[model samples]
Each structure stands twice: as C-alpha cells, then as structure tokens.
Target: NLRALFGYMWAHPGKKLLFMGGEFGQRREWAHESSLEWHALGMDQRHEGVSRWVADLNRVLREQPALHQKDFVNDGFRWVQRGDWEQSVVSFLRLGNEAAPPILVICNFTPVPRLNYRIGVPRGGYWRELLNSDAPMYGGSGLGNYGGCEATPMPYEDFSHSLSITVPPLAALFFKPE
Candidate 1:
C-alpha cells in the first residue's frame, strides 16, 4: 500500500526519488529494455489512487519547508513516540526551516486501527493533517482523524504537550503545526 511507501520515504533521510514505475505499485521486475506498464494504472483504481497520492506527497515535500530543509542534519528530526514494537508505531518530527513549525509523522505498520492514539508533540497547538494514507481518496478504508488535532497540556514522550490522535491500520499520517 501507499502507506508503507510514504512511511519509508518520510521516515528516512535524504532526497526522495523512486525508480520508474515505482509510485503506482509496480509489480513486475525492473527492466531497462521495456517501458513501464503504464496501462496497468487504468486496470484498477488502486493504481490510480497510489499515483495520485505520490504526486501529492511530492507536492507537499516541495511546499513544506519543515519537511525538506536540513535533510542531513539530525537537529531537523526528533522522535515523539517509539518503543512500541508490538504495535509497530513510531512518531517523529521533522524540523525544516528554523522559524517554522516541525512536521509530525506517525506510522502504523500493523493492520490495526489505533483510535485515540496519544502521541507527544513539540507544542500545544493546532496541527493540520497534511496527508493521511488511510483516506478513501487513496483507496484506503477511510479511517483517520477528520482533518487535524489539538494537543493538550499533557506530558507525553518527553514533550509537554500531547495529542490523542487516530492512526489508521497500516497507514502513515503526516501532520503540520499551524
């Protein structure tokens, strides 16, 4: 699913650029002699949805300085929640431009929707959901926070504020402070 794909891209460091035919879940092996199976996109809605999601991700990475700046620097990233290997969830922040707010990325690798998922945040403010892999628009189950979440003044994961959010099954969520 696009969830895992986007998760790996946003979680890891460095510029994100995939190989040809990779965005739409290319099934066949890589071949230098043949063209990509572009026709397969029309074969099912999932492929088209994945293509759209990837485009959106690229647009976001380009538009949001918090997601792009300081790519190789460790200061640009911070962990908000982790050590939940049984549930396979990890939450982190990506700080780009210094003046701007950081981006929060939460991933649910397991196939279990975690409702009311509390995660630590940098501050107690409104955070917008920039992208949700579980949204129906991306051919998912549409299980996710409506749009954004507000962090309460509760200590969480070493942060003074925390947000009880919704992490859909096998999905990756992106949130930006606003």
Candidate 2:
C-alpha cells in the first residue's frame, strides 16, 4: 500500500510515488463505480481509515528528522523483511547520522492477529513504538502491542531480532530507539 512507500519517501523525499485512482478517501471500489459515492464518508471506517493513514504518512514525512532529511539514499534507508508478502507485512530502517538512533518501520496486512512476529532490530537497545495503524483512532481492529522494544540477544546476533508484537490486518507501525 501507499503507507509503506510514503513512509519511505518520508525518509527519502526525492523518491516519487504514483497511487492509482480511488486511493484517497474515495470509496466504492470498482464494483460500485457510481461516481464515488460521496456519502461513503459517513457510511463506514474504510474511507476514514485511508484518509488517516495517508495523513499520518505525510505528517511523519514532514515532522521526523529521519524522514525530513535530504540524505536518504546513502545514509537514510534500508529494507527490513517480514514473513509473508500476501500478509502485506513489511519493514525498513531509517538510518540517522553517525551513531544516531535508527528508526524501524513495520506494516501488517493481515486481518487476523499476528502474534510473536519477529522483526529484527539493527542495534541492541530500547526501541519504542512510534506509530501504529491498529490504534483505535486509525479505524483498525485495535489488536497491537505498543510501548516496548525487543531486548533479547538470541535474535539480535543475526540482525533479525524480533519484537513480540501483535499485528492487526492492514496496519502499519513505526518504531524508534529510546
């Protein structure tokens, strides 16, 4: 989804993205092609959730230094792996200045709860949950773990360190070291 790409653009502004039609607040998918029912706004959480996610992506891109900075190619970004593609769970790293704290980006696409999904952290330290698409305000299932970081060394040795977090389907999350 645009969330991941937009998040990357947040860290790497020079990159460009092209979202297909009906992506922004536009409801009524291809099936109900009736001029995008404007009333869809008040009908359900789907449009609202899309709008919020897009807004949040822009906000993070503009507000965070790791995202706002210009040197994203060589010094800013890297991809982190998730277990499944259909699940739509993906992650990436936003590198800061020398020794500066790196940020972690994660997105979960499954509708069901994903428990014990291992997301490797680059360095060993306390990482805090910065943004979660599963938050109650984001029109999600609200099934996620927050305010913690992976502390064990077993997975850290291989750079595939994982955090014990729950992922709601079609959600995104951002984490940063404290």
Candidate 3:
C-alpha cells in the first residue's frame, strides 16, 4: 500500500516531498532528536524493498519527461479510468511536450488482484511497463505483465487502442509507449 501511495504521488503532477524516514516505511513517528530506524532495513526485506522502490521511483521521475515536464499544467494529465468506487481502480495518462511519450499510470486500491484489466490508450504499439509496485523486488506478490503489454486495435473506453494488463492487488503501474 505504501508503494501504491508513493507511486500515485510520483505520477501525479506536483512537487514531491519525502521526510527522512519515509523512504523505508518507518513505522514510528518522527522525533527531532532521534535518528531514523536504519536498522529496520537490515531486519526486514520489506524495508529494503520500499527503499529500493523509492529509489526506482526517483529514477523514473528523473528519466521520464512526461512525469515532470508539465507538473503544473492542465494539459499534462488525462484520466482514462476514474469514478470506479466499487472496484477502487484509477488510471490516467501523464503527458509532456509533443516529443515526450505519454505515460499510463494505473492504481488498484483493492486487495484483490484484477486480471486482464483493459485500459484505453491514445496510441497503439508496445507499451513498456516501466514500474510495477507489485514486483517481487518491492516485497509484493510478483504479479505483473512480464515487462509490458502491447496495445491492440480493439477500442476501449475513450481510446482507439487498448492494452489488457494485470493489475496486482494494492499496486500501481506505470507504462510508456515505445
């Protein structure tokens, strides 16, 4: 769930702020005098996984122009799926300038895995799965689209093309066209 939250924040248009201990899922409240729970990383795999996940998120944010180029612009973001309260799923596209490829961000808030979930896209081609919060490296169930998924000609939602993907339980995914 922490990964999903972080993924959403990272994908969302805005500046980001991570407190000292948040990168590793520190459970306790922050104290001015006390140091972060550094030992937790050595004690539990989850702590390390979260730390690594944050690092990857940072890397992706830096590498993908679509994520940061239009941080405060109305034209930068578009929703593909929303208002699905019962399923607790949301998906959107983040756009940059004309040169930058749009990124698809999907979040599954429920605990149940959503298999073969189709999502609409603006263009058709190979959409690389740039990030998956449910990957085993992130202390998750290792459910993903095996790197990425190709958009088919079949229309879905509001787009002319679509890609069927596996949205892991309580996970967020990022995809970019190739």
TM-score for all predictions? Answer: 0.94, 0.71, 0.98
Residue 93 CA error for candidate 1 (Å)?
Answer: 0.3
Better of 1 and 3 by lDDT: 3
lDDT string for model 1 (49-144, tens) is 788888888888878887878888988888776577888987778887668778888888888899898898878889899899888888898988
Alpha carbon deviation, residue 3, candidate 3 (Å):
0.6
Overall lDDT per candidate, in order of appearance: 0.83, 0.62, 0.94
**lDDT: which is higher, 1 or 2?**
1
* Candidate 2 global CA lDDT score: 0.62
- Considering every candidate listed, which one attains the maximal TM-score? 3
Tens-digit per-residue lDDT, 1-178, candidate 3: 8999999999999988999899999999999999999999999999999999999999999999999999999999999975667889999999999999999999999999999998899999999999999999999989999999899999888899999999999999999999
* Model 1 bad stretches (over 4 Å): none
lDDT (C-alpha) at residue 140 in model 1: 92
TM-score of 3: 0.98
Which candidate model has the greater lDDT, 2 or 3?
3
Weakest ten-residue segment in model 3 by summed lDDT:
81-90
Q: Would you list the rank order by TM-score, best first?
A: 3, 1, 2
